[model samples]
Target: MLKLVVNNDLHVNKKDTITCKNSCDLFDEITGECSINQGVDIDSPYEAARCGFFIHRDSMSVPEIKDHTHFKFSLMDDIDDDLLDDQEIFHQLVGKSIYKEEYTYPLKPDFSSYRDDAKWFVSPCGSYGCWIVNHYKKPLSIPKSKDVAERGWNNRVYKSPIPLHDHQSALPISSKMAWLIDEDGFGQYALLVNGKISSISAPKPINWKRH
Candidate 1:
């Protein structure tokens, strides 16, 4: 299963027990019986209660890369209408001009192609951006860890390439900010200025190898 490490502290195994915030039925449909606080398993109950949950996409299943041109991109924190309606804040964070690029799959990809494995960058609009690499490639491998205690799924794994010390200034006004580095340190996934996770599936199981 996918292993998620946050700030090099919290570790969670990706499993059915994990829950999502924006993707939850209650958050989306309002009338749905589903609740956001159900079935969550974080190591620390205090952190779990405060951190809540987030949906981390694992794959992209569009018929063709061309079809993804208009895919919506937004920050996970902007799910509420009250937050999204802040046009001034959105523009300040995402900017105005943006670019787009098409990518052909590097390796033959199955129908379950994922974007995290491909080369792409976020746009200024905080929506979709350009694909710097081939789009046809399959998604990157899930991160793994030797420590069982650190071998769990987590939503924070969706955040990677985090802002460095110099980039901290952008954090306050930034519209998007999320990055995840697999346990193996081979792959990376980042959120758009808006907050969309690159993939569709939840974190996958990590393939741990005994030393």
Candidate 2:
């Protein structure tokens, strides 16, 4: 019963409904030309994701974080949303050992342990970038809220101290712009510039929490 807050909406472990402009709708595999520039409808996110196009919100722009303290982190469970606006503020209260004593914050979470389900070459065809979804080896029992109507971004920033490509399990798509699908099968997107992954954005969800 793993729950994920993708694109600011809570989603269950099972496949959910989704619709977006897929590469198949725009790019002609045989012709390799832009056939249809508009969005194509799909009933499932996994189905749309397999086609290699995931919505990136309202814009294709990826904002740069000048300061590490300003990093926007994901706060699951019962946490104040205001703290997400300021990383330094979040660290002061939430990052303290007293708050996360029971939690295990590994040095670097294994991003590759998850199984790759699909990949896509992102472009202006969709929400500005492409994405891939990976499922974890096992399901997790994550918590969720009754009201799933919170509309916003819930992305966590994980800056690798060293280059990910240099690692033994270096992802082949390290040089490409793609979303980091979490164990729940939904996560955020990161920008790989000069082989380095920088600021990451939120991913699209099949359902948006409505007020």
Candidate 3:
């Protein structure tokens, strides 16, 4: 499951029992009181990436806004050496699959200015996907398209229940370069571009809502 290590010491288990370092007043400006064992949930993506734990939203409690906190998360299965090299471990932990797609387009025209020239690829997770604009020398920009209605737009829509595809895209740049389009066209996923794993976008709540 997910394990939280704070300051390389205190271990926060059971969300309800998690407490802050000082007192509630310390986090008064924040969303909720910060107390040890106060019971706060972690983001699914962040949890999966850090602890390799797959926690369902239904099983999670409300999250608190904390700052200047140092925590270390580890996955129970990630301790194994064999699984370390495989990205699948992280994918399975996060409940996402690997997505790769490749296509050729005209290079003479300025395709970067037009969104239609972009090529979309579905991620293994099926929750999110990404698009690549070969002419731009960068990935495509599309909104998240998880919803069927939203998918109607030019954004790449991820098919629910996951799909089987042999499409693979080339980076022409780095070996780790891979673009993933989520079911929603609102976001894109890539590996270590300019020392960053993925691009940042407005955080989407566990469910659809305007925060």
| TM-score of model 1 vs. true structure | 0.19
Question: Which parts of model 2 have CA positions greater than 4 angstroms off?
Answer: 1-118, 121-135, 138-176, 202-211
lDDT of 2 by residue, 164-207 (tens): 11111112222234445444333345543222233344444446
Query: Distance from true position, residue 113, model 1, in Å?
Result: 20
Q: List lDDT for all candidates, in order.
A: 0.30, 0.33, 0.30
lDDT of residue 125 for candidate 3 = 50
Q: In candidate 3, what residue range of length 10 has the lowest lDDT sum?
A: 105-114
Model 1, 1-211: lDDT tens digits are 9998656634544443333432222222332222223244333334333431232233111111111222333433324557446753333233221211432221211112134543434533333323222222344433233222223243322222321111121222122322334444322233233323433212444553333
Q: Give the per-residue lDDT of model 3 (tens digit) for 1-211.
A: 9998667645755353322322111122233422111233332223233321122323211122222112111223324556446564443323222333542322221112123434544455543334442322333443244454233222332322221222222222223223333423333223322122222122233444322
CA lDDT, candidate 2, residue 69: 25
TM-score of each: 0.19, 0.21, 0.19
Quickly count the clashes in candidate 3.
Answer: 33
Identify the runs in model 1 with alpha carbons over 4 angstroms from their true place: 1-27, 30-185, 194-211
Model 2, residue 90: distance off in Å is 35
